[model samples]
Target chain A: MSKNSMKESYKIKDNYNTSIKIKSLVITLICLILTIICLLPIYLLVINATRNTSDILNGATLIPGNETLNNYKNLMALDGFNALTGFKNSFIISGSAALLSVFISALTAYALVVYDFKLRGPAFTFILAVLMIPTQVSAIGFVQFMIKIGFFNTYVPLIVPAMAAPSTVFFIRQFMKSSFPLDIVEAARIDGSSEFRTFLTIGIPLLKPAMSVQLIFAFIANWNNFFTPSLIITRTEKYTLPMMINTLSSDRYTDYGMVYMGIALSIVPLIVVYFILSKYIIEGVALGGVKE
Target chain B: MASNAQRRIKHVSYAKYGYFFIIPFFLVYFIFSFYPLVNTMRYSVEKNLSKEATIYDGEFVGLDNYKHILTSPDKNAEDYYVHAGMREGFLRALSNTFKIWVMNFFPQMILSMILAVWFTDAKLKIPAKGFFKVVMYMPNIITAASVAVLALKMFSNDSFSIVNNTLLNWGLIDEPIQFLADMKLKRTIIAGIQIWMWFGNTMILLMSGIAGINPSLFEAANIDGANSRQVFFRVTVPLLRPILLFTLVTSLIGGMQMFDIPYLFNPGTNRSPGTQTIAAFIYQIYMESRIKNTGHSGAASVVLFIITAALGSIVFYINRDKDEIAAKKQLKKLRKQAAKKAHGGLGL
Candidate 1:
């Protein structure tokens, strides 16, 4: 009786048909295609950098070309543009904005979560209110203010304001609620550490994950920021990478080879950073998934 | 006992330290954020000759700039505020902005929702889920300027036009289509890019919403013999309402401020190429060093702010769920009844 039942069950298992397997195969193909679509443009960017301008007129294929050195030469010879200076300026601005904003925001988050302060509720509410106010509203006056205070055409306007990023502060506060505990601060206080010292030694280390996430976000936002800088930085020498790419595209005789090369160069840092922090970015999305 | 009480008071007074930590944020915000915001309002109503000119030097224009935005003095299609002849007018730019946003947003939400649901569906047995999520999000991280340049180069009716060529290769068209030239085509292409760049972001938000749902709920639905579509609509969609509202509202705000791609491709136009947005209009206004219409730009920015704020509030109001409100009321009533009963007897 047991053997017969075993045989019946085996027959039932075998009855699962080819149609289901084919369905799964189709689903796999669709998913793969979606991934490829996401990835293909970037591949095209890299591939196009190696092809000639005129040669590509016939229609550039996904296939690799032998014109990489020539395109690099073309990019180097492009007038009124310096990739090196743009990269340096971009790095300085984005790096400063990221570090300053994240640290200051974390500091602010630490304050709001750990202590009972006067105006705490109001200040937190103010941050929430300002988060709704998009940057464009004040951009006109910001540029005007920058000009009035002799701040235009300088990185001060770009880097300093990042110190008060309310969004970053809010995000860090959310992370702290779940991950950071108030008792840890009390423990440090009990052990006779200074308040600021406790934050540095105990609070910051715990908020590292949140810090990196905001730092990358702040960095990307600052790096890709073309609007404000376009209004402020009129000179070529002070151009950020995005601004440089815009200038390259807007030129009268836009060189396709040089443009592609410049674009490829601009995305390389972001792509590299993404590869390193891809896991964190995906995870961080969920972390920031819900608004508190 | 008095001394111990005083010591306790002092311990709690360490709350003063909170003020110290919080002050820097407020201070910086006051200078960089608050001050500019107030200054924007002030500048919007005045006629400043140039930014180099003092604020006091400018005449009070009252609502003239704002009025100028709405009631165009010249109904001419080709009228420009500055020598560059870029700005079409405030209203025209605004309409164009909305036009592009509407074209882009509907498609974006629909596609993002489908992609989000499909990728996260458990029964799908999707492969390389992590890889796809990361790659899809890659565009969001990269600069829009670079992406615009890539898009234009690939799609332009030139020898370097990969898209045009592919169509020709596949025998889809006899000639390379003028993607950047035709106004309608240009708007569609611009909208398409916006969709491409943002769907991943929306998908992740939806995925997080899906992840937030309890697994037992899905299991229970399965036990009831609910198919994927029914489960999605009945259980998942209802549970995901807040997330959906958040995405939709935020996307609208973002769409209104859509500048980078259109600005990159079609700079300093009023509403030319059908791709011009309000942001580009404002930027163009500021860029006009020749005319010095900062006040007009300020007015336009104010308008943009109002539109976004109004939509954002609507988001907040809708997201306040009705069932939750009723549940809270019921809980309060039950607690009140329990308290009365306890007072009447030893039912603690």
Candidate 2:
């Protein structure tokens, strides 16, 4: 109970805290190293993109060389590997697909949530069944269908069928059931607003948060998708960024530097999109965890 | 009463609008998705010549293609995997698929467990945790094609290849490893890239699961004089069982259908040394065989579909809650006992 005894107790507590700190420091170091290992391949990629092909073939090192300008020059020099054209093609396909997909999915979701029609149960079950059928299983028939309708190498086949995005519809329907109150729709109807107008004006704005998450996901799905595109898209000019990046690797006489440069270019937009929309994308995937 | 009747009628009429809203989706689904799905079945039962190939030119063989893919005639090839004096394409693809998945999945699950524990532990006080998470998850978001290409180049036998050069320089090997050409090494590199691309996903998923656990549980453990390791094993992992099962099952489904990464490893080609996935084989048959062998491709798809469905249901069954399973078993036992008693009473 004396002052000297209290000071000695305080010193003991301080010693314990420092030991904890040392333990934490070691844990932190280990995590940092693992994180570095995860990112090191990508870092090597970006650094090598800046180096010439000759330098890259000589050896792989952490130190970045200065051939970025020449790499870009050679990359752009290749026919059909034009970054500008690739970006434009990708934006058009993915942007349109995401927008159309989410809009239809939300519309379908709204109908299912708000109305108690006869086919509502069956329709919901149908969507659930569709969710289990992997897209790859349908690839052959889909490509054949596209070719039958003479829609190959066109964006129509890519963008239009997004209306059938069962997962998106399912997610949005769940969101609506949780958040959307029927009274609001009734109130809007009483206010003389048409159903379509009400959905466009009120329902969409209210559903913006959920829609943005699904939209970003749809964009990424369509943007990075290569297998289907590779099947249907025959022309070089019609190629999306992923398809273009693949070509960079598989070309007969390949330039590793140029390929890396192209890969770097393809990923930058996604990383930018992630920084902007990562909060929602992460939350969306987590939301799916609870659903499962 | 009359006004109420009128409102009721209008409301009933308004209900029809549901049909209006859903029609576009159903229409597109039926035309683009459902139609093709059924058509794949149709294509599965046909035969044609490489049929320089026009659509609708093949004759229906009625399960011949299925038979061919499910049974191989070559009993002695001197090389390649054979079972029952034969090698089925479907079986080889099934085995290859599982081999690649197991190679990546077990290691990924363990590593992610450790990382999830590290980053989520407040006591660890890991610096720059956000930055690390973002970097680690970078590969998952990037196109699989790019990852494949980068991996192929990195693991190649070239003197400048990082994997080869590093190992060679460290005197770990006498010569460069033929990562691309060697059968085992090819699968290893593919599996390694898959692990690289996905471990972060599994980690993030596990981290979310950890965060979802009640904080009071950890406090109770602490009060009981539990150490961090004890808390992790006893308090944390048990609570994370559902999430872990979720991750495991979803990854199983995803890994089974893996195509782009393997295909991109060696594009425009029918064969890769050791990296042929089921989905990749389907793509190869559909692309290379033209119109004549459409049934063969369709058969492969059917096989893949069956595998995915069967495995998915099995995983779900395996991961069913223990309490629910026990309760169901008890109910079944009670029903049997009741039935037996009724039968004995009837005999009396």
Name the best candidate (by DockQ).
Answer: 1
- Model 2: how far is B286 from its true place, Å? 1.3
lDDT of 2 by residue, B1-348 (tens): 545544754655577778999998999999988888787777877764364554566687787667667765445644224223123556667788889999999999999899888887776667778777776776778878777777767776666677887777787988887776776777877888888888877888888889899989989998998998899899999999877886787778788788877778763343663677788777776776544346767777777677666656655454334663587699999998988898997765
Stretches of candidate 2 exceeding 4 Å from the true structure: A1-20, A289-292, B1-13, B49-51, B72-87, B166-174, B267-270, B290-292, B311-348
Name the top lDDT candidate. Answer: 1
- Candidate 1's chain A scores what TM-score? 0.90
DockQ of the two-chain complex in candidate 1: 0.55
Model 1 / residue A6 / CA error / Å: 11
DockQ of each: 0.55, 0.46
All candidates: interface RMSD: 3.1, 3.4
Considering only chain A, what is the TM-score of each predicted structure?
A: 0.90, 0.88
Error of 2 at A196 (Å): 1.4
